[model samples]
Target: MKHKEYRRVVTGHNAEGTAIIESDQMASQMLERPNRPGVRLTNFWLTDQTPAEYDGPTETCTGDFILHPPQHGSVFRCVEFMPEDPEVMARLSSEDGANAFAEMGAGANIVQGGRHPWMHRTDSVDYGIVMNGEIWMLMDNEEDDVLLKAGDVVVQRGTNHAWANRGTEPCTIMFVLIDGVTQAGGGKGIPPR
Candidate 1:
């Protein structure tokens, strides 16, 4: 269950030794907690290094973030890391997102990472559930901001957002998504996605 060299544009760092439990069936469900329903997972694994990948044009990102494509472009996950600076986060979430150029939308979520990190997409709706660690949902739109513990869920839409990892340790989550644009600037790389 250790994955090495896992890289994904949607991910900020890479995970190693992943143990995925593919099944939306009752088996994957934690029926013990009705408040926290079971989740349908596809690719789940483990990793050692977790952080922002500094490969982009900034120094806030580093680590091995990977995205695996199912046969025939089915759908998958993308993880990312943001700096401690809100200003930097804003820049990355804006038209000049230094970390990414992809237009993510629909079927997305925060699977793992820091606490209170901002999540969004330009063309995809997100669905996220915390696997380990803790996080706080910024609550974009007219929703009440909520804190996500070990077992919390979040659903976000295509908009401008950011995340704040307010934990002594790195925060992590498990999310599922599909149908998203992987290009910046109208998905054609013309500038502005």
Candidate 2:
């Protein structure tokens, strides 16, 4: 899939307390995993704390683009998912999935024996907005996949899930992942299914 570069315009207050454009440029922090071919992540911005403070013109996502958000923060990114390839899916292994997640600093998020190799869980509340094309949101149950289209919004709480694009074009979804604690009380882990 050919990824599209999005323009990011950031605004901030100047020394005199007037609003101004901090930075306006194309977002170039695109991450593509070799193991997960055709999947691309374009990170726009990130905040490292809740009630996010405005520290005036700072680059927050200068480091590696990890899957989970910062400890007490949130991440804003757009993920592009290409149409699924049966051969590629068949070739995927648990070790491959583990390696991919490990590279994203979420080794423990991978679901070992789930329905799909890409099925994983995160300890965050994610707001996913389908921007283009369509995708199927697969959960733990095999019979309950939800089909999402452009303009659709899904509030994905911490759950074991994966995305599958079955259409001809690539599916683009903007995601805002915020650090969350499960109601079950564990702090960091998948909630009970």
For model 1, give the 10-residue run with minimal summed lDDT: 28-37
Clash count in backbone of candidate 1: 55
- Write one digit per residue (lDDT tens) for candidate 1, span 24-48: 2211111111111121123332222
* RMSD values, in order shown: 15.5, 2.4
In candidate 1, stretches whose alpha carbon ends up further than 4 angstroms from where it belongs are 1-74, 78-99, 102-119, 141-143, 157-160, 180-193
- TM-scores of the candidates are 0.39, 0.93
* Candidate 1 local lDDT, residue 123: 40
Per-model lDDT: 0.36, 0.87
Best TM-score among the predictions, by candidate number: 2
lDDT of 2 by residue, 50-148 (tens): 789886345677888799999799999999999989888988866678888898888788889777778888888999999999999998897889999
- Largest lDDT belongs to which candidate? 2
